[model samples]
Target: MCRTTLTLGLTGLALLHAGPAATWLPVVRRRLPGLAGAGDADHVALTFDDGPDPRSTPRFLAELDRLGCRATFFVVGETLARHPDLGRRTVAEGHEVAVHGWRHRNALLTRPGRVTGEIARAADLVAAVTGAEPVWYRPPYGVLSAETLTAARRRGLRPVLWTTWGRDWTRSADPDSVLATLAPGLRGGATVLLHDCDHTSAPGAWRSALGALPGLVARCRELGLRVGPLAEHGVS
Candidate 1:
């Protein structure tokens, strides 16, 4: 009976964790009220979230520089506070820096006023670093509420969503698996979601998503896809 209970508990936890990725709303196809669909042309936009880490972001930027690609980075305000120079470097490298919220908080859980504060504060910080307010906002974990969207719009930012996600937040995520997840929709106008930072800390630590970069970029090139900044596709 105890073993059975343990198994059930583990199964429940697994389902709870998997629910977010499976049920996340696809915001890419949903048109915001005010924006016109100029649409993307012959290119895919690469975006990274929950970032500005000191250990991993520099390497990610270096790889982007080497590949001659520019990506959109959605940075958390608190993390930006901790790594201000890294945020500056991201802009200096010609990548777009957008807001991921303050403290990586779930937008759904936050009150409208609080959400406004979180987004506005983050946008201000990003502007301070890069000299422009962020024009795009991607909610943490892809969770959103109507209030979140309204607040973002009022701030003059558009809610940008992903066409593909790698679940790169997982420590056990295989680079090949990440590649496979993104293989199908990797045509023009695709926004690929990845992470430049892993919050986990361990000896000989792994940055699972960052590990998948070279493989993913090579695959994009092999398919004759252009990878560039999200703004180029008129995402905002």
Candidate 2:
């Protein structure tokens, strides 16, 4: 293979396995604030990503209300735009919204200007439709490039990633499987990642998340910890 091809292939592998952006990239990591109270042992941040999806998001919201637990919804710019009313309802229901990039494109492979510009633009779109600019940002697929991090800072948003996740984005994920994966990571100040929409994931994967929500919330309470949005964690 040509040197250029070899370099590109290796870079893709690195970006995929380079740990979480908020921790992996030093330049960006410096500006990124780790979720506060992540070590508090009595608080956990329940964050749902890639949402404001009309079909699945409303279901997640309904479940959260039923369980009396609150969560942060990291919404996509395109999805929110397509379903502005859904975005409005997500905020109106007392959930915090954050940017998840425009159309869920992978920042690592995207151009720097595009990455940075979209961050600002998505922030604007979210703010205009949701009645507030998101104070936090999570990259699409949770993958961030150096420029994406810079863009996050330029937009005045904090970058965050989870301590653990449900793996609920997979088609094989079921309620029990989701709970099993997440329960081990349950603790105060832990950030739990789960997808509210599966647009970028396995089809119907959102069902596993929705099915897992009640038990997850109950488990948190039973452990004497409270589940809340990232804003509640004071990371924003």
For this target, which candidate reaches the highest lDDT against the unseen true structure? 2
lDDT of each: 0.70, 0.76
Q: Stretches of candidate 1 above 4 Å error?
A: 1-21, 24-41, 200-206
Index of the highest-TM-score prediction: 2
Candidate 1 backbone clash number: 0
| After superposition, candidate 2 runs with Cα above 4 Å error | 1-39
Q: 1-236, model 1: which lDDT tens digit per residue?
A: 22332232233332334224343233224433112112365677889887888888898898888878899999999999989999888998899999888877555455657887888889889999888779888777555556666677788878766777776666556777777777776666678878887752232122556667787778778877778767887554
Please give, for residues 108-204, the per-residue lDDT of candidate 2 as tens digits. Answer: 6776588788888889998999888799888765665567667888889877767777888777889999999988778777888888988777898
Candidate 1 local accuracy as lDDT?
0.70
RMSD of 2: 5.6
TM-score of 2: 0.86
| lDDT against true structure, model 2 | 0.76
